[model samples]
Target: MSATATADLISRAQSGDHDAFRALTAPHVRELQVHCYRMLGSLQDAEDALQDSLLTAWRGLDRFEGRASLRTWLYKITTNRCLNARRSAARRRAHEWDIPGVHPPDPTRLGEVVWLEPLPDALVAGGVDALPGPEAHYERVESISLAFVTALQLLPRRQLAVLILRDVLGFPAKETADMLDSSVESVTSALKRARASLDRQRLSNPDREPPPAPRSRSEQELLATFVRAYEAADLEAVVALLTDDVFISMPPMPYEYEGLDTVAEFCARIFRAGRRFELVPTRANGQPAFGTYLRTPDGTSNGVGLFVLTLAGDRISAMTRFEKGVLPWFALPRSLPARGGLPGSRP
Candidate 1:
């Protein structure tokens, strides 16, 4: 709806017009959810925050003067809610790291936020409508990458908010200041800190190649090679698909393996463990991903993790393996049957 039409609807909704309110708010729901996901790093949390924000928006419509657009007003509510939720909560959830009795090498670094979750591409594929607003420094798709989101979690609450608002969402410092109920100087300072923190992470940054938009041809080929190489237990083949600077990090554990050789050697250990895996393709964080089921010594397959890939051209630049329990969030089955196609995957 045009701004004028949305304003008219907002006016009606303010006067107990529930239908008008829904109409006015529905258009922003997807973007708000994305915003919330960026803030909290978990889709479920984002939904909860967004739901609460919408209700709050409905009730507080009387206070929403015409000075700011409805989108901006709603974002302020959602961001604040996420901030509060983040402050009181443990961002990472603890889970068993490896197959029972089978441990990979000591992690390269212990990960801080273990509970990061994936956002499905279906929600992100704006298709013809997915253009970034003029101010967006990060591509809408790139902004949601697991690496980017994970890096985002490392920032202080205020810095994280500033970075997302100013860099990803393209909100100006003045607008961000008003949203946070702070001075523009404070917002600017926070953004600088956030950028510095993100730069320090050495993952996704302006220097890196822009992330492929969703599933580009190069990304798909890399993903296919990954599945084939992994399933076949071909170390050389697997190594061939990774970029020289490829990294593999298992979140919730800071142990990160950087560089192709380093990551390949680490993965080779898993292959040498006599474990076999089956890959079922899926999408997460607007990138190619797989449901990885490890075949145990018992000959039964078990859901181990959901591995997401970040691609640069035909090479896999980075990969992250999240908790196995996150599969259901992507509508993927929690467990897959064994190689025989029987339901062999145990939790």
Candidate 2:
């Protein structure tokens, strides 16, 4: 992990030693992915950008004269790729749906913030292979929290990059300015604006601790109860687990139903359709999630939803339902077998 060792590995990697290349790059992969995610909020988009950046790095490896650390060099490539991606036709197509809710909610309660997305803490917590260095790992988890990322997404792209590089990643102002191709003063100004925007969006009820490591024992029990209640179409039991201010939002389709009563009504309506759900548990954004497959009225299971649960203390505070296409990202099947009996039925 020393500078000299890293330099040697980079040299070998450039010379086409695949193992050496991996050794040089392995330690920084998670962080790079996170950087990509910050630039592109969609997980899928981040993965694509990371792949593009890696390929570019490989192709240009021989040209790396090490004026900057290998890490900084890779980051430059990543940031550029993300910037290009943000200008692509596909990105343009995606933005058409960014404005959430065709029929705006009563502004008195939910406010106009739509376009919200979930981020699993595992992705941001440096994942399973994070480096052990304290300075490198410090506040990394907090830096990628849903609240923080959402605030970041609201900033102009250049400002977002400046803030992340200068504030969260602690890059020197000179280096950050160079990355954005702006003056140090401009970088400082952008960082200030970005911080102010984030301050305005800070959660009113911030957790006393870092968001509890996702999927704790309590979360598991609550998710189980949710699965049972939802699959059984038991409105009362399901309502019991929701916070008074629970919010449900389905993205790529902008209607946010808020409060336990409204959320319960939505669930009840779905239940009355005679469509049952099969919940497959997974983790995203450091929270409990289920790849939700729905059974048709005719009793055939088909992928229809990806449900991510957000818990504040013991009660469910939010449920985000993503489209079925997201099933594959969570490694879920397009469809499942229909239930032979009611939920909790023994084989």
Candidate 3:
């Protein structure tokens, strides 16, 4: 919109015109939500923070002096809100295993960031454009991956804010400093420390092979093969598709299994009771995912969990399982009737 039109809209909004306020902020809501998701690492929390930020903006609209673009100003509000949420002690806690009659193998280690959540592909496609700016070190896709986000949650809150603003969102150092009410030198120092810490966490490794292009024939074939093997409970077939360094983690539950052998053993224990699953294909965080349903004796399948796969080239490198509570976020149903007595297949 032209400057004059925006000024008029701002004037109307500042005069308590709710419609004018919505019009002025509608263009930015999705991207701002994504920014919150990156900072807080939970879709629900992001939505909460976004709502809180918008409310704060609406209440404080008169203070918007038009010095920065409205989008940047919205981001400023959203980011600070997320930082406050992160600093709170009530962040989602790790969940204990509640699956009846299923005992998993001992995990290699306990995951520290258990509140990590997946971002739906559709939501991301709606909000994110191309890379934010020239200073961005990570591509839009890599930046949102579970590995990257998990690593982000480990940083000091200020360092996290600075790194995301300077590197991921590509905000200039001075602008980031202004947003945090810190000096440029402070922002620069925080970003430098954040980058080194993140590299040590292996958020991105230069030598790693990228996954197959989204929805490419190769990706489709790999996903299909995985689903078939997984549903059939063919441990050997499933294990064949894994990279040697593959790991499996279930959040909410802190258990994490690393390496092909350990992950294979965990799968073996899960299937030891002849348990079978019905897999529904989906995508999360730009990677292939599935809604896993446990087959029941009553001729129906019950939603059990969501599994998101991370690929390195054609091999599966990581699998992250979320509790069934996340099913609705992916638009997956909680249950499905038997496949007319035929073998279950992808819907």
Candidate 4:
């Protein structure tokens, strides 16, 4: 992981050693992908950008003269690629989620009321390579949560990068300025603007209180109950775990379902249709998650999507379901076995 070691690996990789290239870059890939996600807000886009950055780095390896650390060089390339991607025509197109045969929930139930993307908690929590400075000052998990990321999307791109590089990623002001190719003073100004914008936004959310730390006993208990209720297909039990004013949304689709009553109705309808769910536990944005699989009466298992739960106190405040294509990002299978012993499940 040292500069010399990286240089040697790069040399070997450039001389036709594929294994060397993998060895050199494998350790940083996961975290780098997460960085890409933060910049792009789309998992698919992040993966594509990461691949592009890697290829660019590989092809331009000869030009990389040790002026910066290999990690820093790759980061520069990756960040530039993501920023360029954000400016592309594709970014202007509104991304939509397609959930076959299901209507989107009403918008009244959404917490922050944004059409933001879903990210795996494991990806954010597990990938923390650039943790510079005091650990005490860094609330890494909280900073990367869905709530925080959505808020970040509201800021100007440069301010977003400044805040992330300085606060979330813990880079110093000087280093952040260097990365963004701005002066330290400009980085400071951008950070202030970003913070002010986020503060104004947060003030609008009446329920936006500082959440308790993750992995507390209460959080664990809540997640456990959710898993149990979901696995048993117990609609009522699931409703019991939700806050009275809970919100449910399936992104990439326009529907939003709000309140305990409405969410209960939605769940009841699905359950009444004899649709059973298999909840595979996972995490996203520092929140508990389940890779949701639907089982039809015929016993076929189909990949419904990913359900990422946001916990407030001991109750479930929000549930954001992402599309099936997101499964690969978390290393989940495209399809799973149905509960009723059916082969070739739709998933």
TM-score of each candidate structure, all chains considered together: 0.87, 0.80, 0.96, 0.79
Model 2, runs deviating above 4 Å: 1-5, 13-23, 89-142, 145-147, 204-213, 297-300, 338-347
Expressed as tens digits, the lDDT of each residue in 36-124 for candidate 3 is: 88898888888999999999999999999988888788888888988998888487778898767778788899999888898998888
- Could you give candidate 1's per-residue lDDT for residues 171-279 as a string of tens digits? 8778889999999999988888888887788765455575555566766666777787888789999898888888787765556787777887888888787777877
Instruction: State the lDDT of candidate 2 residue by residue for 1-347, as single tens digits.
Output: 98889878988898899899878888788888988887777777788899999889888899998877788888888888888886672541222222222223332233222444555545656742444233232265556655466567667878788777766777788777766678989988887898788778654356422333555776677788888888777889999988887777666565668777787777776666565677888876656788877666666678877887777766788787777767776667898766577554524
Q: 1 or 3: which has the higher lDDT?
A: 3
Off by over 4 Å in 4: 10-22, 92-105, 109-117, 121-126, 135-138, 203-220, 228-236, 257-275, 331-347
Task: Specify the highest-lDDT model's number.
Answer: 3
Candidate 3 lDDT trough over 10 residues, lowest sum: 338-347
State candidate 1's TM-score.
0.87
- A best-first ranking of the candidates according to their TM-score comes to 3, 1, 2, 4
Can you rank all candidates by lDDT, best first?
Answer: 3, 1, 4, 2
lDDT of 4 at 317: 81
